[model samples]
Target: MLRARVELRELARDWRSWCKAIAEAAEKTLGSSRVYVFGSAAEGYATGGSDVDVLVVAGRLPRSFRLRGEIKARIEEEAGLPLYHPFEIHLATWKEAEANPIYREAIEKGKIINAQGLDSMKPIGESFGESRGRLPDRSLGQR
Candidate 1:
């Protein structure tokens, strides 16, 4: 039983390291973006079968949904992780993230893995006008 526990710990460590690598790759892929780890991974309850949940909020991204996977692919490639890696990576523009319930939950409950140098950009979901990749100011009563 003790041996099993030790092995589980080692496996968890490996998963965390891999998640960190993916986060780093995402940071490089989307410059000036925020990367967060949510779900079991962020809560430190991940098991061997758990999928790493990552949320990446960027100032800009291709508007088409079809092109989103292309960006994620770049991060996977940079991380040396397979496209089928046990990761649930999400890419969101600041506006999209602000409007998305799942992204909101992740932002609220997740851990920011690439905090260094992330503060140079404006706060997430802040008013930057209706421009692409920017969140509209809800405080102004603009829908």
Candidate 2:
């Protein structure tokens, strides 16, 4: 979708540094090996204040670490302006990506990002399976 591309491009130009920072944290703490952008950000039609939805694939993480609040706060501080959209980072594993229908659909429709979790990304399908259509607009990561 156009919204997804525009929103992600805007983030790349503006919030990419912060996003990589978060990815570093994810890799270190969540055992993530890769990250990707999905949902509206991947669809290329996002407007102002569109939230970013990213996926992280890796081994399981410890329960103690949380990236959302801390990364968001730091990014907001560094930018000197609050992001119009919230950072929605999803944590999953390769097994989950394969086993979970929704995650699989996201991968199929998402755009891979070169970030801290991993510089290289694997290719995925383009069509969303009928049973696994687009998830909620609020947070693809959440589902």
Candidate 3:
């Protein structure tokens, strides 16, 4: 349990650093997009071993997939944590996110580290709760 506490602290610190790093890297590489923190981290469910999840919303996908890979690899190396398994890179226009219910939900929960593409990131409508059918009720209180 003591070890778990230490790990949790480390994970929290790393999450902050990784989010900052990703925002900086995205600014340098993508130039005209927004970077957001999502998933467990955004929802305040992150634990000691949680992976840092993010969404890079852009008008267009990066021209260099290699660049994207490099950015992700560097984040992993720097954070000393494997990225959230099957890390997502949702490439879509702002309009696309506005139209998609799922994407809108993510954006609603997401915290914007950098808002370059637009002045600020806005939630389209009310954010939805995680589906009750998916997560066990007991786990919600465990954290």
Candidate 4:
């Protein structure tokens, strides 16, 4: 039991390190783009099987570059762990990202680890009720 627990802890640490390394690698290779960690990891709800989701918004990659695949390979090789699975890479120009409502919404909710072009990488924790109008209390028997 103790051995199993130790192995699990090591695995968790390795997964986190891989995620960080992947983020760093993307930052180094991509250049001047906003990199975010979204989905389960971003929301602090990740378990043993969450793939690292990175959103890259900047100038488009060159035609010769397979950015997502390259990043995945590099991370796999560097980390020596098969922690990353079929990850999601949403690429867009900065202008395009700003114009898209979904992007805005993600930015408003997602965790920005390395917000290059953006001002800050802090998480936007504003409640929907606070941002807009008050929401009816569903549990209070009033709507």
lDDT of each: 0.67, 0.54, 0.54, 0.53
Measured on C-alpha atoms, candidate 3 has an lDDT of 0.54
List, residue by residue over 1-143, the lDDT tens digit for candidate 3: 77655665675655655566566666565556566677777677877666556766665554577866776565445534543332344544466666776666666667666523233333222212443222112223310
lDDT of 1 by residue, 28-84 (tens): 887767676778877778877677777888878998877898898888888777434
CA shift of 20, model 4, Å: 2.5
Which sections of candidate 4 miss by over 4 Å? Answer: 1-16, 63-87, 99-102, 115-121, 124-143
Taking all chains together, the TM-score of candidate 3 against the true structure is 0.53
Per-residue accuracy of model 2 over 16-81 as CA lDDT, tens digit each? 454566555555554435556777656766555677677766554434346444643453454343
Pick by TM-score: which candidate is best? 1
Residues 1-143 of candidate 4 have per-residue lDDT tens digits of 67655555555535444445555655666655555556776677777645556666556564445865675466456535444243455665555556877665555567555413233345644422334222223344221
List residue ranges in candidate 1 displaced over 4 A. 1-13, 115-143
Q: Give the TM-score of candidate 1.
A: 0.68
In model 1, where is the ten-residue run with the lowest total lDDT? 120-129
